[model samples]
Target: MNVSRCDLLRWQFDFTWSLFDYHLERLQPADFLWEPAALCWTVRPDATGTWVPDWAETELDPVPVPTIGWLSWHIGW
Candidate 1:
């Protein structure tokens, strides 16, 4: 069966929204802001009044770890 382009898009959107909604529903307030690492990026402001990743100030030798808070904003946006 050949599915129309619009049907495919709607299916994709529904699937994605279902998965996103499932995760969001399961996420707790504390878990949403949990930082698993010492240098995980979050929504907290820094000394410069900027909400930057905790690893933002660190050298770029290693990639910065993103926290749940960061991921939520990043994914939503």
Candidate 2:
């Protein structure tokens, strides 16, 4: 009945990722790229032509919504 701090953190992390994986299984390609609004963050090519997140485009005032691709990348990596 005793859990170390590291053990607790690991359990929480695992559970969170499990939930993420579950939902990820249900995502479609269109769902992954869906942008509810303009200026939202999502995955795209960087200046170097490597695929990267568009987090730099985000602003805090309006709290821009993130696309599923961005959420997936954020949680998966």
Candidate 3:
């Protein structure tokens, strides 16, 4: 597989991934949030104030950090 990733400034691409603006770059972990869709919906802020899992508030949590790494790798690491 041949892939390449780029880290663009947030100001230039705010939530572009969610909108499918471009697939050439991977958004940083702090660039977005993660809204939980369980029995009761909740909003938790990620590194960049994007709603993510509440547990992500800790450094050793299994939420944003891991998910972001996975997304980054999938986007070409």
Candidate 4:
């Protein structure tokens, strides 16, 4: 199945979140708790042990943005 751009992004975020949840809990949740406006999700009883990342508002991520130039190959003629 083809996933859209937003779905792709959601998958990425959810995947990372799931990994973190593994360390905190032994069992998986029953379903995916999606927060549409926040663009994130939460599993039932997943990672409630520690202070989780706030999905309510966009936090200042330390992640570096990709470097792109105007003449990059991505720019099609």
Which candidate tops lDDT?
2
Which structure among the candidates has the greatest TM-score?
A: 2
Per-model TM-score, in order, reads 0.56, 0.76, 0.19, 0.29
Candidates sorted by TM-score, best first: 2, 1, 4, 3
After best superposition, candidate 1 residue 39: deviation in angstroms? 1.1
Name the candidate, 2 or 4, with the larger TM-score value.
2
Task: Return the clash pairs for model 3, or none.
Answer: 33-50, 34-51, 34-52, 44-51, 44-52
Model 1, 1-77: lDDT tens digits are 99999999999978877787789888887986787877566777778897654435456655667777787676566
The TM-score of candidate 1 is 0.56
The true-structure Cα RMSD of candidate 1 reads 4.9
Error of 1 at 3 (Å): 11
lDDT of 1 at 7: 100
Instruction: List the candidates ranked by lDDT, beginning with the highest.
Output: 2, 1, 3, 4
lDDT string, candidate 4, 1-77, tens digits: 88899999988878866764564355333222324333333322336564233333555455322212111111211
Which clashing pairs does model 2 show? none
lDDT agreement with native, every candidate: 0.73, 0.86, 0.41, 0.40
- Candidate 4 residue pairs in backbone clash: none
Model 3 TM-score (2 dp) = 0.19
